[model samples]
Target: MNEESNSKGIAMDLLQHFEDILESDPLIDELGFIHPSQFDLLNEESGISCNSFDEANCQSTDKILSEQSSKQENVYFWNKDHKLGISTHILLPLYKDAKHSFLTALKRYKTCSNQSNKDGDCLPASSSCDLESLLMRHSRSLLLLSCDFMTAWNSRKLVVSKKKQHSMFLNELILSGLVLSYSPKSEQAWNHRRWVIKSISAISSNLKDILEKESELVEKIAERSKMNYRAWNHRCWLISYMTREQVIDELKKSRSWAELHVADNCCFHYRSQLMLKIMKDSSCLVETVSFSHMVDIDKAWKDELDWNGTLIKRYVGREALWLYRRFISSCWINHFLTDSGDASHHFKESITNYHDFGTFLKKELCLIDYCSTVVDNEFGDFEAQAMHSASYLLWLKVKVPKPLENELLEKMRVIELKTLVEKSYPERSSLFNYFMS
Candidate 1:
């Protein structure tokens, strides 16, 4: 019985040690699980091995942890470099205790909050404050151990939101970022981040820096996490809040990353969304639009169209590029070629003045004509190029502005495009014929 009591005492002490470490280090950005043997290896020099959670070993581990705490330092073995590691052996004990404590505090917090403002029905003010603090600390630890716990995350949100403390909201950002450090794809963590942002934006005004930081965070995560659709989706969602100048800046900044990742349709989609936003904003102006900004927008279109052509020529068979072209081409004809210069507003009658759009259509025809003539390679990339080009032209046929609706007939024939598709991709020839004819 003495031995069992001693072990329990050490376990509680170990839990306190972890709590103290977290309290001391608010900058811990990453958390991971480590093997018990590895934890022992880390403590070899201190003459302590936590290979067994038995009473004797537990006592020694607690002593060393105290010594390290007293010394005001912790190295990479368990906590260092702004990262915290948990031993697999103690994971169950630690998680159980942490989660239990968090849930208890959360229940008390809910009770306190549910009580009317009339007063004596709930715990006293001091006690309620302590309960909220306890919930926050416990929820942090629980989330580090298990990020998918929506209740814990939602509980934290409730506490922070009820208090509406700016510092507390910032701390929530740090907490969610820590969760994302390990589980970048955790939808709960990401959603919690969005919630925090929404809450903050409701009160704070100068959010340009905050939005920029969020964009950078997405890019940094995307670098390490491949094909992260959620991250990109979050970035695209941020476009709504950005200033027009910031939108243009984002366009210039994200170009390099997009170029390096030509195949990532999400990134291209992000770019298209940004471009469309600029057009939408320019058109929605009740006042006259900025001439300089309009000129810049025109230059942006020219650069993008030329850049798309260069990318298509350099990297043949990229479906993403073709798709991007279709979007930009549609945007160009509707916004630039039309008289009103607003695609989203309405399509005006500019058919007789289709001189500019007619030229744009000619450029597109030449591109597909070049791609379809390329010889097939071992990977059949040329064939894919032909199919995408053929498809783009066919799509453009139906999508052209109503004003220039019949103008495409004079520039390119549907029969010729179907033949281009059939040349390298005979299998889809009938499908193309059915759609085009």
Candidate 2:
């Protein structure tokens, strides 16, 4: 019993200290802490100032300033350890106080949640709405410390549901975005944002503008972190509600990003999804579409193919562009090149369209040959590049007409390609041999 009382007293003291710091706004010199001039010099060296914490108003200014002070002090200690170094142990008490405050708020929230549950009413009564507000404030504090805390997020959702405040839902989005700015890959934070959006959609009518801005935000995040699968997945989810024109606009914008990031398969996969949506749209059906629209679609596919070819030549060892080529080729054969007939007739026409299919295959083969020759003559890793190019040719060979397959798969060339692959990548010799056979 005495130990419990002592623990309670410590928590109370820490809480008092935290509140004091917030209300007093004590300067560094006033607290007998580091000098103001020294703090300014440290901020200059780190290129970050305590004043910057004011801009991130998502959290309490006191906690944010403490964290910033801790970071700057650590950096200063490292840089000045040889001359006038001071121990950074003073910051430990600040962090401990923050942790204590977080835990105290968490405990209070749990108690409030349990009390509401036990009363058989998840929603707080009008008389106890103040309790709900307090719980929400605690949740916000906890989330600022650990954005992935699902329990705190759930509590906030419950509070919002009970309050039915449209403004609160909007504020939740800002909070989640602040979390994302620090941890871009937090699934829980992203999920909370989605929930907030869903709730807002129930009330707001201007969601189209909001979603467009969201798409742009995801694009910026993708640019910072290549191959962010979650961001790409969110983008795909957003496409279901997009208009045909908006989808086409997004497709055009994404083409340059995909070309610049040749090795990121996520962007290529996203492109394939967008293309499928375009092809499957009712307005794009051959009977309903204008001649000009059909011509535009054909031109887009041709341009994508040419772009993929260029990327393949520029980046020799990348397989993502090759995979994208397969997607584009299959889509083109199924939708654009073949006539809109029965499956058997379409299959037959795909093979017999010498003007289109035959020319495409010949051009692709020439590209492969040119790439292989360049790799052999100029690149230091001849065998690896040769193997990559040869594997692509092998894929193309299977797609050719059976009568011309043997002609395309010349025995001497296959043997030489196999020998180079075996020498360069001996670990996969068995797989290579099996494929060759």
Candidate 3:
């Protein structure tokens, strides 16, 4: 009974050992594991034949060979789960020996990486941690997700010597979506490409080379999806990342491209956003139209009042028109309230269309003589505050000469002095309230 019980115990231990091996073995291409390409270095280059064998051991040897081949394939694809070949087979014996050590390192390293990111070290590190870079101090959490355990280990060995390559691995790991965001893998891929371009070392790679490669990536993605805001945003980021002259040149080139494709608002909106970003960053607003040929609003209609009438009749009923009017008002307030940009041109555009709230108010004030209507009485004071506020800002901007430069200041001063004296109505107090605010 003792011997039988001992035999059963030995069998159970063997069973448990097999189970552990099965669990530890790397995954085979099953389920959602779609292998996009199969260029395994070992499988392609090594000419060792696993097919031929004697009859006695043929079946077992075939199974072993197949498993070994699969493992080899996995390692070379590194992006795929694979084990090292014969040279590293010795390490397999040590796997059990070092299991606890490996697990401890993995846990400690992952925690350290999370802390680093939480500490906001990723931004500065991102410049050096890019795809194709062969050197980075730490792989961070990237090592945990890489399918090729041995390759990942080898890559880490190069961390100190080949900084660029290490960075590149991190970049690839990110693009591979083994780290960073997983839900949007493609986004991570594109971002990784951008990061890699931006990470080019000044010692190893020319700045122009990096900028060109990034521009090419941007154009490639932009061409693939012209409406991709992310691509456009990346392009803008790349341009901003480049030299000052490069930024301006890129802006000019992209602006031309944007204007050529005016059939859709996506490009228009992209151009506007890019221009806004540039203006915000440089604090240099381009007042004059980049393109020489202007769309004549006067020629579009017969007269200024006719243009306003046409605009109101055509678009006043639209919700988009109301939203647009609000947007124009907001833009004016944000961009031109303190007369930050071209004051005259901004006001001219705002007041050009009757659908514009300010223009609408101008006509209404002339008719109402600042008196409250029945609707105003019901709504409690008309809340015509938006219109009144915008008019007063325009008035104050005109009154303040310090906000303007020589040419624009002189031009606006004449306009402001003329309007201030000419318009003396009861609602003039509303202008004072706006100025104070």
lDDT of 1 by residue, 246-324 (tens): 9999998999898888888888899999999988887776246555556667678878988988898888899999999
What C-alpha lDDT do the candidate models reach, one value each? 0.75, 0.61, 0.38
Q: How many backbone clashes does candidate 1 have?
A: 0
lDDT of 2 at 364: 70
Model 3 has how many clashing residue pairs?
15
lDDT of 1: 0.75
Prediction-by-prediction clash tally: 0, 0, 15
Between candidates 1 and 2, which one is better according to TM-score? 1
TM-score sort, best first: 1, 2, 3
Off by over 4 Å in 1: 1-11, 36-77, 113-118, 121-125, 290-292, 338-355, 402-406, 413-418, 431-437
lDDT of 1 at 228: 93
- Candidate 1 has what TM-score? 0.83
Please give the ranking of all candidate structures by lDDT, highest first, separated by commas. Answer: 1, 2, 3
User: In candidate 2, what are the lDDT values of residues 67-146, reduced to their tens digit?
Assistant: 34333322212122112222233244433554555556556656767887787665556636666655665565456446
lDDT of 3 by residue, 1-437 (tens): 66555544533332233223323443321112213132233334453222432211111111122124432322111211323122122123223323433445445544545676688553355543442132221232223233334434443434423555545543443333332122222454455545555445433444665566556555554554556666556655655555545655664566455434433344444444444454454334235533121222212212322322333333222222223223333443454334455434544454344233344334423322322122333443233333332343354344433433233333333233334323423456455444433
